[model samples]
Target chain A: MPGPTALNFSEATSHDMFAQRLPQSKDDSLPQVLAAAVTHLHALIRELRPTQADWRKVIEFLTDVGHASDERRQEWVLLSDLLGASALVEEINSRRPKTATPNTVRGPFFRADVPQLPLGGNISLDGIGETLDVFGRVQDLDGDPIANAEIITWQANAQGFYENQQPDLQPEFNLRGCFRTDTDGRFHYRTIKPCGYGVPDDGPVGKLLRQAGYPLCRPAHLHFMIKAPEFETVTTHIYDGSDPHLAEDAIFAVKPELVRTFEQQGKGWLLKLTFIMVRARRGAGT
Target chain B: MPGPTALNFSEATSHDMFAQRLPQSKDDSLPQVLAAAVTHLHALIRELRPTQADWRKVIEFLTDVGHASDERRQEWVLLSDLLGASALVEEINSRRPKTATPNTVRGPFFRADVPQLPLGGNISLDGIGETLDVFGRVQDLDGDPIANAEIITWQANAQGFYENQQPDLQPEFNLRGCFRTDTDGRFHYRTIKPCGYGVPDDGPVGKLLRQAGYPLCRPAHLHFMIKAPEFETVTTHIYDGSDPHLAEDAIFAVKPELVRTFEQQGKGWLLKLTFIMVRARRGAGT
Candidate 1:
């Protein structure tokens, strides 16, 4: 016969007992984060009181999202963006001073190896859209120029597709380039005006959005990543103020300070703006 | 040039804007559940203020979990189980009267097609470990016998491995059987005493548990699913009260009412228990 045992179960204290048995980690924050996650997750379950079938659906949906992701595609990131989680994380992490440029999501289309271009060089090799000349200066919050700052930028074509997305139709590096600031912290580049585009909607994330009756189009915007020694690198975007989707960007990444007007220049257009950067804190290594 | 546009971005209202823009569904509960999920998720991000790198790790972990899951194995379910989510969901959804048999997680090992056995029939085809005889009565709250109630049960072998997990070593349908209650609400089955076993630990969920220093073994228990017309089907376990892991079942499924002692019976062991079922609500379709 087996030994005598205790049978002192209490339903009222079950949740607390479960919480107390959570795994402890040597990394302090891991336990704390996991505890918070468990607390909120249990609360959500209690509130929703989901049936077994409902719980199964959630697991299946998550599995589908995972299966749809690969090196070239990130369905999970898209889900996060659609849920406004990415934007919320950016806001929480990038609480910069009013004078400094704000940070935004880097998005999934960024490629690190685009060819560098000389000032005034054109990035729109295919030249499919109306010509756009963009001039910008990289400077500190005090308005002092930061020389030799690296400015990398990319955007969709007139058809609302990135070059990588349409490799067969668009030229290599079409509307994508890297440039260095002049001694005066000034840089200029020529490109085609981008158009609003739909986020990839063939995956499970898209299915959820469609079921929720949410729009899939993001407002037209130009992506930029600016970096310099001893300064905080900013990954941001410049949205065309006139884009119809500005008020309802699918990813909720629109910020008024990041929007600009494209003034008519002859038969083309001209966009002029300044990027204000913040210096890194002393003894804080990036 | 494009027309003038509004750039009235308000970071303070961004979360509310995103929430308001959440996809509405004809299915009211979908919207409600998603809204709650988003609210809690956003609060988690705000509280943790995770760095981009930290966020990336979470995505990567979830992706790994998804990748590891397939038709035969469910890493996501294992994750939910390890985090006490499945138990919480079960508790919330299975709030029955005190006299009714409580529900526990069905777990991932249930097979729908086990062979039915006659009374006193042995389910341990290989006849491994100490012989155990389990006789139980099925009845309603009024203490009346429930004739013909179907009782299906399965358990791990002495080596703590299911037949499916070790197909080559164990006979097909080893330690699994289905039986019906006699006119007196009595049913009996013979089986080998089960040992506590580790969950599938080769997957990402196991990695997380190991990192957190949590035990991977569930207490030794025999699974049962009982059903009859006009009654609620219950999925539960009869845990060995003498098992060392009873106090810390990895899945947090143990309840005092569900634990029992195995008494010495001649050369073998015998366990006696009664299962009380609750009637289903009228017109509540199964």
Candidate 2:
């Protein structure tokens, strides 16, 4: 609420006070901070020498990024990430052990209220694709079992389309569901193999990457957002090693450790991996 | 420019066809790059799992950044830096030089077509503000005088307002001018001392910095974009010490080495510094 108040108020008044004039008293923190930006900005403008047309092109591109979003897609997150701002902020804010699983961009496909299901529950809708059984144990930073941990997953179908993408083709919640770990911190799920897919590039991310000669494919993987009380939620992806583009996914996400190799046995491959979560440091008054 | 046509048209279509669709045989390099971006994008979306509102926020922020730009400002560049995309891309593209000056965001306050004044030109307008003599030598990587180099300089008045900021109080280009190096690659200018100033806090960088608890003030500095016929143009700032808020300038631009201590004499102070520029490798095109 106070955001709009401060932002909108400054424009109307103090036309020359900011960027040129200093605050009178000891409380000139905001003005001082802004001066550096403006000064640097002034120099940058000289070097860049962008014309009005160049400015409009960027504006139109940004507007198109907005117009490209829909109920099933999010172009903004992709743009933030390709631009490197999202990943940089994440690195600045979320510093954890490199040995511990690294966190990348949290994409725009998760639902807030995924229906909670019991441990050992099968989340696959009608279990149609490859019959793979997945099991994992959850632990805290100190390798302690984090009982009652919640594991949520959502992925595209065999053709790499989510249920939201094709309501008529896929069942509601197909390859999407939530499961809480048991007392031993172990959980299991039965689902089909997820195929790798590409982002919605009919928009700005596509435009930029296309110009810069970047690829637009992600290897097959299952999405996971694991959470428990007092611990940091690890939103991650487990990529299948066999996917064609596992190494060169455009987002630069393919941690050698995150890619798990699957062994095909009888009818399907058995997927088993242990998950380790870290306890979050509480801020002041948290 | 081939900028717009560089983005492929065919792959910039629907989601199902766009994902994982790398250009293989006939799609040309553009399609290959665009398809790659979409592929990773598809995964990024699955991973970040952003809501529609979250997606809209990013688009709106970028739009506002572009919309905030004017002749005197370019918020889009600042936005790119704030997002960490620029630095990352630069790091990826440019070779890291430990001794060489680091490249940073070229802010948006520089004006084009600064008059080419001769060596030892006095750029101070009407003897306004505090009197100071600024001198500098431009040298090659091996300490050779970069003769005939062009050095453009500008700064705010004692009140911290540039000539452009206040047309009434200051003359046109009051504190801004350009000077060329002598055959020995040296130049000098007489100007008034500029105090620290704030950027327009009403802009996007200001709003975001305040929200992030970043102080908005910057130390005083002169703008410099040095260029020689055969050398890579270097756009940088020469910082002034003895200014308040030097340590916590919100833009992260306080380089201790770049600061020149002013020596007080009878009436004015003299600040001397040297610009060590790396020469462009022979035949290296800009």
Candidate 3:
């Protein structure tokens, strides 16, 4: 084949021109990184051989994603999540030892500084669904219990809405609480078992799921943020293995270690698992 | 590797789930098209293995592009154009016979319903720069002239800003005119030579270009849209071959065949060329 005549030449030459354009800076290489991304994306488009209409559709979709975003709605995050970029990012950034608990997205509903409760304190303020006692031990890599670790937890209610999503309908702090691990490293709390539900699908991402024939649902799961003085703070999820969407989370965040069985008790359910934490890398905790 | 244990499982399996989730629709296969884009993008991300920070940077850049867009300014089009998608699209959609003039971008400044003028009429209202008499013949593939073809032309003023960019400074239709070919398929009009300048670079794209160290300039050129009954309408640019940025057009829209030389005359410049048109595909004109 003729090597990129002017008629066939935009990508390669421009890629080089773009790559060489990055300004040299010591503060951040983000500009260089972005230039590389542009080049790669250009090459990919050329490989795909998209029509003008196809390219316009992409531009429109991205514009809609931006218009959909807000402090509360974060449509860009939703887009990243749907595209599996968020999961990939989480995986790349938090590479834990095999024995430590796997990380998942700290979904938008999490709030800091919730009231710290004692063991087995109930966090279900609205009385919306079946209750469950989620008890777990915070352990170190060698299986030693980590005492006094702070565990902040939250999740959507049984009907798929977070308390923040319907502040008018739900009471304050509905299904949100913070607790501390005992000397034995065990912590427990009571709240409604979070039901699997679709993500906020009313936005552009939702429109995409609706059009693509994909469900907007994320599997039922519990959100946890665990912190200890000597260990890396971990933000993650514990999915109910039985949730129908487990195999197809909208965010593609499922990890085998994070899936736990919720057994039926007399009145509600019981979930017990041991979370292992890895020591923070030197200077990482600061 | 144990076939994607907790640390490595999401992408491979979820890719399938995402592909299968696309909705079945007969109205438009946009969903299918989106599915393919998503799949390709996901695979590309996997290949690139971008860090969490890298991914976040992309999200932020796209968000800025969206926020920067408006009816008057198309930041996303600038972005696509900079990345060469626009050029690729023009290449893919406007495949012409060897003799036909190649198509390029109809940049944001083009205004439809322009005032039509007689042959040898003046298009320049401000008379801001050295005048040029541009004469051309519209011909068919076999080199026979096509009489009475409509030639729509527009370009920047001497200062490198389109008339639309500064309505207060330049008169309405300052450098825009539509002319009909005379007998023997010849058309002529007078307008000042456009000066090369950067694109609208105060927006996010400008920030990006600055950060990436790219000159935002495009070569000086005249835009043309030619149409005739029973023939394909052609949108193209005739760039000044002497413009310094000819080899580095910001939008990558420059093609070898579109480069023209300006010959100096007694009081102005003369740019003469033959534009070949191809017959319209059957039923396309209806």
lDDT agreement of model 2 with the native: 0.62
Where is model 2 more than 4 Å wrong at Cα? A1-48, A284-286, B1-286
Error (Å) of candidate 2 at residue A90 is: 3.1
Please tell me which model should have the higher DockQ, number 1 or number 3: 1
Q: Compare candidates 2 and 3 on lDDT and give the better one.
A: 3
Q: How far is A17's C-alpha from truth in model 3 (Å)?
A: 6.1
Report residue A147 deviation for candidate 3 (angstroms): 6.0
Report the lDDT tens digits of candidate 2 across residue range A68-161: 6655666766776554334433443345675566555566667666787776667777667787788888986677788988888887777777
Would candidate 3 be rated incorrect, acceptable, medium or high by CAPRI criteria?
acceptable
How would the candidate models be sorted by DockQ, starting from the highest? Answer: 1, 3, 2
Q: If chain B of candidate 2 is superposed on the true chain B, what is its TM-score?
A: 0.77
Clash pairs for candidate 3: A21-B212, A212-B22, A212-B23, A213-B23
Q: Write the per-residue lDDT of candidate 1 for residues B1-286, one digit (tens) a residue.
A: 2222332323355456555766555556666777788877887787788887798888888889988887667788888888888887877777689988998888877788999999999999998899999999999999999999999999999888888778899998999999999999999999988988888788888887766666788888899999888988989999987887876777877877788998888888889989998888997633
lDDT string, candidate 3, B43-160, tens digits: 6676667766567677787778777776556777777777666876786677788778988887767888689888888989877899998989999999899999999999998889
* Candidate with the larger lDDT of 1 and 3: 1
- Among all windows of 10 consecutive residues in model 1 chain B, the one with the lowest summed lDDT is B1-10
TM-score per prediction, in order, is 0.86, 0.49, 0.82
